[model samples]
Target: MHRAKLASFAFPDRPAGDAMSVIAPQAAVPRPVSRVLVVSGDAALTEQIVRGLNATAQRLDNPHGLVALAVAQVDQALARVGSDGELQVVLIDDGAADLAGSGPAADLAVQLAALRPELSLYRLLPADAGGSSGRRAFDGVAGEAIAGWFDRGEVDPVGWFRILAAEVAEKAATPFYDRLKAYVALAKDSWHTPGHAGGDAYLGSPWVADFHDFVGEELLRADLSVSVPMLDSLLHPGGVIAQAQQLAARAFGARRTYFVTNGSSTSNKVICQTLLAPGDTLLLDRNCHKSVHHAVILSGARPVYLDSSVQPHLGLFGPVPQVRLLQAIEAHPQARALILTSCTYDGLRYDLAPIVAAAHARGIKVVVDEAWYAHARFHPELRPTALECGADYVTQSTHKVLSAFSQAAMIHVNDPDFDAHLFRENFNMHASTSPQYALIASLDVARRQAVMEGWRLLDRSLRFAAELREQIDATGAFRVLTLDELLADEVRGDGIRLDPTKLTIDIGASGWNADELARVLLERHNIQIEKATHRTLTLLVTMGTTRSKVSRLMDAMQRLAREARSRAPASRPVPRRLPELPHFNRLACLPRDAFYEAGERLPLLDDSGQPNAALIDRVCCDQIVPYPPGIPVLVPGQVIDVAALTYLVRLLRTQQATDLHGLADVDGERQLRVLRREEAAPGLAPAV
Candidate 1:
């Protein structure tokens, strides 16, 4: 039995009448070992060892129980081993010990034993420790070595019991596994098309207990085929899904809205496919989202690029300038539409009304990728959202700020020129054929929440952001970028006034790059901020933020500022520039043609000169978006730029590097496919 009090370990000879015994009666019972640590230098090896322990317990009808860490620090190992229900054993990975600095094996064992007198240590080395690349089959020779260790006192009774307990707990606590088992027992009808009739006589699916655990059992239970009543009807839509779309439109102050489960990237494609055709020109922002470029490819539109002023001080990208917008429109009189980002990820808000008016005067349509600024609609203090500013097509990520699940977004139609029916048709085509009812429900709930409390919540967020800025400024190590004071000045003329809710801290005074500061904060204090670049660290405040959390962050910032002030001022690096623009005729392939062709994946280095026809991947195991102001460097259906490639190469080298190269596709292992040379012949596919 586990003790209610851990004091028993320290005071084993306490009097029977003591208050400790009175409060924790269970302390009298001998404690069953609870905590454990399985260590390995190789991440893959550690995982395999843990898996083998679970598999062994399964064969013997034992519970597999143990907590594992891959190459942890000395303090972390000691802390875990020294707990009330302290760890019983440490599994040392011999291979990892050799790779890492030596002495960890013997040193860790001594430290763990000192921390917990009852704890034991287990040493695990590959069978061929000195030969054969140290890679042996776990079931073959490695398993035998492990079995021999089990026989010796080294593995011991505690190790065996801990492994057994882990398996038992895993089996008992999983709700998803239970739900899957229950579903199997339900009677089958000819109601779904997994197409196998729930694995009938010819094909029985092997029972996998972990499916529900992967994505929640309720979602699996609700994953009914289109024939099920939950989906209105994919062949001819009209039902609950359609109603959800209507609700989104109403809440966001739009005449019409389309639900896109595919994400804003695909929504962008649909907007272009429905509106533009070959020979048309689009007034494009230099700092445009990747999706907009993809739209240009699909729509066969020629883009008139409007250059944006790069903020040299911040080493950041901002909104397109008004002069450039006018210049582009004047230069390309045949332009049919305009597109831009309103509130940049760094929270910069562009003065778009004047630009919107200029485009509308020419009877041109406007589409704004307000993806990051989805919360702009609820607060009047925030810049007028695309819809409020009279943009023809406003694409927003309701899921982004409003708390809907990812891939749940809305395409609002605010202009008479936009065809609602056409937008819906493309939305359904690009989105999932098997749409989730829960996703629909989440969109509905987010919309309702935003309508009811968005303004009040945003107002609170604004105050919190302001307070944080003030505190950071008081320390003299950083200053918050505010549009109110800065926009009126000459030096900040190129910068857009920012939303009050955006807490963008300029760390120029601290003499450290934003990247270094970000790492320090997370490693030392366990606090995470948004992406940090050369000059700025951005923090986004939402309705979920509280004053206490802000205060803690403030304290941490002050401590970091103190540390940084003592260091020599960092040398400022000269600003970088974009490469010579690629020759559009030779570099880009029409999306319609690329869509019908097949290609292969190549490394980012090998991809130079070769046409890149897909969006650049950015995040860690997420859609590839370069975080602070996540505009893609390489857009889909466009050739990769040397300058953009250089930017990505530098990003990959930093501690921020998660993936090796920024080449592969976002969702899965599928490679980016561009049109082959044979498919790009004249008249085979016409271009703008």
Candidate 2:
């Protein structure tokens, strides 16, 4: 059994800049764990080796003191190695070693080394005098070699054991960063696409000069084109860009990971284009981003949407019920792929292990839209990641929850079963030929941060989340959803656990609802949340969230609960029941067909001054999507109904800024774009 606890293995206190210093002293608490794993038949010799390891490790300032796992055979060794995240080295006694596998000692050692790339391996041979039990049995030139491995003194040479090192280590190894630095040093002439190359072009221009200064000369200097050979090309990476991707793939536990500079929106489109085709069934969840619908429209895929389950009291869509997934799979078994959103905008995640297994059994490919879950894999407390849950394809917005710059995302592929050549072609189609070098670097370093510092940062983030939840709960006016609530009898087996970082506060039953609550927080308290729904408001906490900001928010909520609701406007209309999303049967044709067909624009309301729900045989040619939820109420070719109108009207009335998209008013006319009634035949091919 793995004895090391992540709780105890928390890196020791180091100087402010030494972020990669896992071995350092802290007088407050000296945790245990020195040596990683030791394999030997002799009890005394193993003890001596453990003692030697502890002496060196403790002196080097490791808080986790003297950790040594003595396994008699390789089976137990592999199990121990796999289970422990703190393993650093492995030593085998070749003489009396009863290895777990059926192989020679050297072969067994090689096999164990393959288990973890970071683990150092050594073999203990017979001594000259006392055959197996000498005091110097563990001492030799080989023993010196064993000590030499530890004595090299660096904790993790590859930088995998820690988060982003404050300073990128000075080595010949970092290809991408090295190339960029060298290119910037040259300060060469630029005949590039970006007009402000080297910031000289903006120097004399009146309006652009101030903006150029604001952006800084150094930044523009590094924003070089793909034509620069040393800097490497994103379109067809060979030198540095390819190496960076491989490093990230290994760090994130994926077979391969493609970096995207254009955010997960383009990443989603690439995945769709690669795995799906025109008329191919795509089992999609209705509660996905607007970008997903666009992908469907672009690919002309036949969509079979999963029934969205609602959190009745909260007005949020809960996880798709297990039965709903089963029914969809049974109905659309011919579907080429399935895409599910885990850790969605409001922080709901399905237990995907079982679902992925069930789909894979039927030869179905699974893709999880994990745009908000790049930091999930680093923490044990969080829900398991898409790759961990056996998805064939997964996309993550690295910038969302991790430390990457905005618009930077990662697409991880685990499918040895699909066409690699086709996937590469599709990736090139969506990804820009000349990507921003900074964005690519941000993703590279973000992956490093997630691997190295993720645990530390996430631990702090979760702790902060718990504090907010507690503070909010204490007020007794505002309420938050907990995993316990989702696990209760009426809601059990729905496969959900809240992302603690996404604090979804229920303000509906506070007698104030979301609009009034959001207004008071923004106008009076000067605190802004992410988005507010009819019944809820969401606040996103990432690695960068601080305790002080959280405290301010909590204090603001306390005041809002005690005074703001009662003191605020009174005539607020309580929202009616949230309308169920329009089903697939409501469509006149596939989304792509309506998307390209000739569309007519008409007033959203009738001449009698009401919603034009009574319009004679008009099909919606736009995805009527509100901003916060962004899930379309009706996609192209879908028949708009009274229920859809009811939801839209209530949504507009309660929302603070009232952001509605897709359908718009055209020049003094409140308009709805629809397939013209005259040509609205159900199966008519779109006029290309």
Candidate 3:
């Protein structure tokens, strides 16, 4: 709005005497515009548009706020975005265009054309006022070629702007992937890491060589190192990787996207490690993956754990009740971040859109671990993904749902306050120096596939899952978990829906527990599920899941359910419940402190009341994680209490394979590694 602000609008206005900020100045060139800039004109509807943009900016706490530049002339509008590319799409007043190339609008168009050159400028006529993203009913849609480039149509102005912005970004970015492909095709000399050297050099063993022959030479060739200059480095990707990330950012509706090869775990850690500092408070979902706790330990942030509501019917953790979550937010006003588990392992999730806004309003960063929801945005029923919900940070395990190789993942960043350098530093710290090139390429291909064929693939997946659910319910032995079950509370309050691609099966009333049913499927039949809880088995219906496979899975489940009912006595396993917390557990010592403290292994006591107050109050110096979901029950330095201890003990009894990391349970003698409290440690909150 003010001429004095134009030059500095690209950078945030520095507050006078505001000593320091957590955010470091970044090169805004690599970042997308999170806010919109509206240039005013004489049209009566200009004010409404301006209001809409400003309201959105305020709502999202967009790092870039609204700037109403009142420019009577075209030069002023050009001046707003010319020197600084910080301005998002500029919306000119309605009917303000003069095709004659003489009026203010035409003058502005000429300047944009002369400067930016190839920017796609589309004109859309709206039938009526619409919502944000400007989605509206099209009356007459037609295309008029502009130098065989421009097309005319009537649609949502907001949607058009987003599409236009993405196209412009993609066009401007260098094609790193194309160059890498070209380099791969060259089939150059054997040079880099991995002693095999592209599977060309024989190992001098017939069996090993035969294995290599079977695996093919391309596997090793594509597993090239970062030394290959043609395929740019991921850590400092200014080339193809950056372009891929930008493409991902747009595809995922993010301001920025960072590719993570280690999986969503590393992505989760990166978000926390970058945003939080030592002693800072972060609101955490009690049911979050253990990696979030690992990030907390690494960052030295204090966690204000939110309680999870246990689903009695399914024996699973539902979302932290919104009322309870809001109360936690109100309690910890100074929290640096709010981390939520968007969808649980069994497909239970909350509509975090409203929560993100609420958390953002309190100046808290929002991070959602949507690790199981990489394909959520492909369909409308699975709408309002964490990215669409406006979370500051969202992590997805692409391989879990998409066709990418295992360990290929991505982090979508949409926050204005995100520190890219800080994130990269952590990412580099965790990422391998000799990265997997094939996985990286797969991520690129996966992103493209999702962008191109996602809708059709997801639609098919939904049909498959829905049909199986209906068929399974008809068998009478299993009752399928519905979106209605998870959204009962949310639907009544907000319109947030569930991902139809994930199926949660309930056999709580049957003779078989989840593990028993899962075992039968894996051993008797050749079907495996994503995860299993006490009373439910979770199946991930992905893009690759076919109708034939769905039919087989349904048939197997029905037969197994009928057999269990007839052959086995009806005995229902108790639904797992979060243990009631103790005073010491509620007031956790910092996880970072506990993680670093000296610890000694001591025999674990089964009786909760038998452990001395000294033992219970002492900081835990070991991670006590349960298998399956592998979430931490007690992280290092946190006070160990009856509830957490009890939960862990139960978990140890029921937990199966996949590495029970950080636990000290050996044979029948349970042991715990706890912090050896010194006499000189700082005082806690006087034991409440």
Candidate 4:
């Protein structure tokens, strides 16, 4: 039996003086009960176990009470457990052998474990069964799924209760966050580098008092600095921060995990800097985030771009075909690393196991940018995560899908040859010495939350998305993009999967472009979507998504559909044709060289407002990226072609709502940065 005393601490939100002023004895607050579900067809056995648990709870004077409910069928047990967030332990009666190895009960246990990995499952055996020497113990999946087994006649209820209490306490611990809260409760005066000195600068001034008040006193007070040695230094963690990171590593299934406060973008850059050197070859996914492109430039790696299948109709880019990816690995055997994004922005996931295996065979490291897939490892349905696929390094934006503040991310290392000292140096290069203590605490708390309830939260989000997809599809004016619709013909049978939580709705039938519909939804219905293309809107169903939000979104979509149907034929808007996405295949020089070289901005259009064909073959010196899907259309050192230039011209003319990053407005005309003509050496061979 394990018993750990719970820590007693004052709430950080309460003033220090108030904590000291409370001297009177107060009534004991009701402790939350630990819910246990007993699955058994025998009423007598069920009552016996429930009575024992209740009596044990009373006898021990448990700080947390106990409640047990019995369900006859495995289906009912599963349903109850799924819906009850407080339920922790499950006891199944297997005396009848109905739930013996590989039976329905065994399957139910596996599913319940997946839905709540922290849940404790035990099998109840008959008294004589344990004494039978010929009886074989549970084996295989059933044996592994169950936490323990108990013979009813010899059951130790008090021991079981203590074990449950210890497990709960372990999962509830957030080392860094708890310490931060306790330190804040001390009400220590700060004379640190932060000039605000715990918001005193703002609170004392009338000019900024409103701003400070709006931001709240608790947040301001908790905004601490490195001067407080107890909080531990992020760069050289040896205390609570180190413990928090180790806990996160165990939760996320990483060999080692490092918390990153500068978002996954910086995480990618740090990894790149640590792994790659100038002139090293890299195999990269073309559909990756712009941050990857920036990493290439900063690391000075020679990139061999892998083509992603394009869906011209929906303006979407699918994952690289498995065949193409494998062939690229073979072709670029000299490549130092292979980096790709799993669960692309629209939620297209690649079967990375084979891909990672192939990359490893060639002595090339695999780095997966799972920036939007922080919750993938927590659920069984979302298994085969990058780490599980043998990736050397994985970067995740915890804030995107989990309960963390923005810019909070993590870098997970599983490399066989990872050099901690070198990685730490690179991490410190990108990390700020004056890091936000609140953000770090948020990361610590986020890890604890995910470990405790990630499966339940994800299960709810998946169901919500499914319900919304069906409702939206029935609206006639809109239809959710199924896997078949999202995948291009070339990559149809590539073992690709769609994340059900990400819904991409095709709104072509609604008679409104995606931008117009998004604006209407935000303005009229107070609803905001994740991203929008010309004819589709993508919505993310995250842990934060609620039933009320799902219902409100459906209601808004139905109203829009009705309005579309009522509109006159002449009033219905015509759909606009978008240009095919351009490919960045022409590498005239090294990206590092071109980016560092002298460049001049030239008008994209002539006086007549037509594209200046003269600039077609010029070498681009900067990245020209489209905003919604932040993939760069033209990267540095690429020789601009007619197709690429025409696509840019079309976007400038028709897609005024789209933001082109590298284009500048000079004399009221859009211009691009290109290397000087003299600098474009003659007969320069393509780098790729």
lDDT of each: 0.58, 0.70, 0.65, 0.82
TM for every model, in the order presented, reads 0.58, 0.76, 0.72, 0.85
Misplaced by over 4 Å in model 2 are 1-174, 202-209, 484-491, 509-527, 565-584, 613-617, 649-658, 677-688
- Worst lDDT run of 10 residues, candidate 2, spans 163-172
lDDT of 1 by residue, 1-688 (tens): 2213334332332235754443452466432223346655566665665565555544554332343334444555555543323243466555464434535455555545433322345556555453344323233423322321232113333465555364334222323223333444464465566543443312223564334344543455545566665346533557655665665665566888776666788878888777777756677775677777667766767565565545545546667666767666666667788888777777676777777788888888888888878887666556467776788888887777777778877788888876667766766667677765455556666775564445556767877887888898998888887764323233254436677776778787777666677898899888898666656777878766776678789999999888877776546432222222222222254434444345445444334533232424211111234553445444434444455545565655442423433357545432334344444522322122
Which segments of model 3 are wrong by more than 4 Å? Answer: 1-177, 202-204, 484-496, 568-584, 606-614, 650-661, 666-668, 683-688
Which predicted model would earn the best lDDT?
4
User: Of the candidates shown, which would achieve the greatest TM-score relative to the real structure?
Assistant: 4
Instruction: Summing lDDT over every window of 10 consecutive residues in candidate 4, give the lowest-scoring window.
Output: 6-15
Model 4 residue runs over 4 Å out of place are: 1-53, 59-155, 677-688
| lDDT-based ranking | 4, 2, 3, 1
- Candidate 1 lDDT score relative to the true structure: 0.58
What's model 2's lDDT at 337?
88
The alpha-carbon deviation from the true structure for residue 459 of candidate 2, after best TM-score superposition, in angstroms, is 1.3
Query: Residue 459 error for model 4, in Å?
Result: 2.2
Instruction: Please write out the lDDT profile of model 4 over residues 365-434, one tens digit for every residue.
Output: 9999999889987766677688978999999999999999999999999999998999999999989999
Please give the clash total of every predicted structure, in order: 15, 12, 4, 0
* Tens digit of per-residue lDDT, candidate 2, span 1-688: 1223223233433436755434444324423232457776666666666565555544554443434557777677767765664454576666554555455555555555444433455555544323435324445423333322221122232231111111112111345766787888987988976676777787878878777667766777888777688877777778788888887776666898888999999989989999888888888888777788899889988777665666555556656677778677776778888889887888778889988888887777998899988888776667467887899999999998898889999989998786878888998998888789889888877876665446566878887898888988888777876765523243376667778899888765566757777888899888888887767788888888876678778888888787645754565446454544444336677788888887888776667766666543568877888765567777887776667766676665556544678767777556777887676444633311
Clashing pairs in 3: 134-156, 176-240, 594-637, 620-637
For candidate 4, the lDDT comes to 0.82
RMSD for all candidates, in order, please: 25.6, 9.7, 16.3, 7.3
Q: How many backbone clashes does candidate 2 have?
A: 12
